[model samples]
Target: MELTSGWADPEPMAEGGIAGLSPYLQDRLEREAIPKSGKDALPPEQDRLLDQLLSAAFRE
Candidate 1:
């Protein structure tokens, strides 16, 4: 659920936070968790609907 706000920010390591991590750990996390781009997120229609639902559910 890391894409399309399904989870936390897509590229959570953008600040190079993984640099201090072990090579193997960094490699594994990058390979498995990093999303390429927003275009790789959920399809447009579903993403829009999901956003609407989340917004309503979180209404102030």
Candidate 2:
């Protein structure tokens, strides 16, 4: 499926927010929780929610 738009904007981190964090913590956050470009797959729960939303919108 081609998703042309409607991607949600990521919330901006506060200035200097991550600077005080340890390198290990920063690396972990980037690798796990933080979103990055080119990663198109959503977690299964999110996929289910999206499917349900589309189904409901199109139901007649």
The residue ranges of model 2 lying beyond 4 angstroms of the native Cα positions read: 1-44
lDDT per prediction?
A: 0.51, 0.51
Can you write out model 2's per-residue Cα lDDT over 1-60, one digit (the tens) per residue? Answer: 988889689665322234223456456667787633223433235566579769889998
Ten-residue segment with the worst summed lDDT in candidate 2? 13-22
| Candidate 1: residue 45 lDDT (0-100) | 56
lDDT of 1 by residue, 23-56 (tens): 5655666688853333333433556657976998
User: In candidate 1, which residue ranges exceed 4 Å CA deviation?
Assistant: 1-44
What CA RMSD would you report for each candidate? 16.3, 18.3
Error of 1 at 26 (Å): 45
